[model samples]
Target: MPAINQQSEPVIEIRELVTYYGERKILDGINLTVESGEIMVVMGGSGSGKSTLLRHLLSLNRPAAGNIRLFGQEVNKLSSRALHQMRQRIGVSFQGGALFNSLNVEENVAFPLREHTRLDDNTIRIMARMKLEVVNLAGFEKLMPSQLSGGMIKRAALARAIVMDPKLLFFDEPSAGLDPVVSADLDELILRLRDAMGVTIVVVTHELESAFRIADRITVLDKGKILITGTTQEVKESDNPRVQNLLNRRTEDIPVNADEYLQRLTDDLAGL
Candidate 1:
């Protein structure tokens, strides 16, 4: 397939992004930028708030204080209609593929077009099949989600994501359940999509090897704060101990308050 050949632009811009779930801060003062055609990976350990960060970026959760602009328009201030219009310019490939179990691959891929466009059924089918071809799943378009292999499911979801020909794409845990070989293949596919479609890609994954292989830059988060946003080599050679601990898989020593732990386990329900 031929490339989209678009000019460079800033697709995602965030400044001082702060998020909270009740009283606990999930993302603290995050500042980030993803230029067109870049593959920026967000990596963190469990509870490091990587998933929370993704949710905010996707506008699923409101942040306590921050500015987020996609395609030069501020997202937080947009109205319902404006937000929907803005979102149509981007696509998301969920962590689990999220293909409808009831729908075949082609229908799942075409669903977005059907909902968003005035196009006829044949046009939607042709477009969906074209994307399927792009993902190398052309012949399997009629197969049900349950019938496809793990990798095929991922590729199919990807085909759906790009069927809209979005300028930005977000992937959540793209390699989460796949084997090493399959994960590597998916990584290459991500790179190809970026190069061929010129889409700015943001991937949220905890897999270190895959992050190193596919990322143009990586943002590492710990305890709801950004450790560093740098190239693969820069991040790999980071001097921050937290970054080193995450990279080396070493355990971090977090001091626990005995009183707080006791309170959590023993809620004073006796008074009630």
Candidate 2:
């Protein structure tokens, strides 16, 4: 990936972002910035709050604390109508593709246009096909999602995501459940999308190879806290033990306090 202009205002800015589910803290004081036309990959183990962070970025959940600014607007401060308008500038490609099983590929891609714009049917069809062509799925639009292969489904979902020509694109595990060849192809497609469309992209994944392949910069999170954010090489050379453990696939030996453990068990039994 090429270097982006550092002086440009970031398309996505997060500061001290905190989220909670009941009494459990899912995201703890996160701070991140994503520059225009850059591909930022966020990676972490399960329960590391990566998913929660995505939810906050998408404005699907209100953070317990801190601010998320998208295209210079604070998401949490927006009214429902304003929020919907803001969302029009953003696109999400879900991990499972999330296409309507009953709808064919063309219909799925046209859904956004029909809901958001009053474009005529012919215009919508042409625009949707153009987007599908961009994703290399031009002729497959007539097929249902179930009739396509895994790779095709992902490509179709990506077509729908980009059909609106959003300024920011969010991808969840683009390479998951695909073979190495298909995964590499998807990675290349991601790079091409950034280069051709100049859309800022945020990818959430745990796959190291995929992250390293597509990311201009990478942010690693551990236990609800960010461990490091840097170029891929910088992250690979990080001296942090947790980062090393994650990259090397080593398990951390977390020592337990016997008294605290026993007391917690006792408390559970007493409550029961």
Residue-level lDDT of model 1, residues 188-230, one tens digit each, is 9999998788788999999999999999889998989999999
Q: How many backbone clashes does candidate 2 have?
A: 0
lDDT of each: 0.91, 0.93
Which candidate number maximizes lDDT? 2
* Candidate 2 TM-score to native: 0.96
| TM-score of every model versus the real structure | 0.92, 0.96
Q: Which candidate leads in TM-score?
A: 2
lDDT of 2 by residue, 30-54 (tens): 9999999899999999899998999
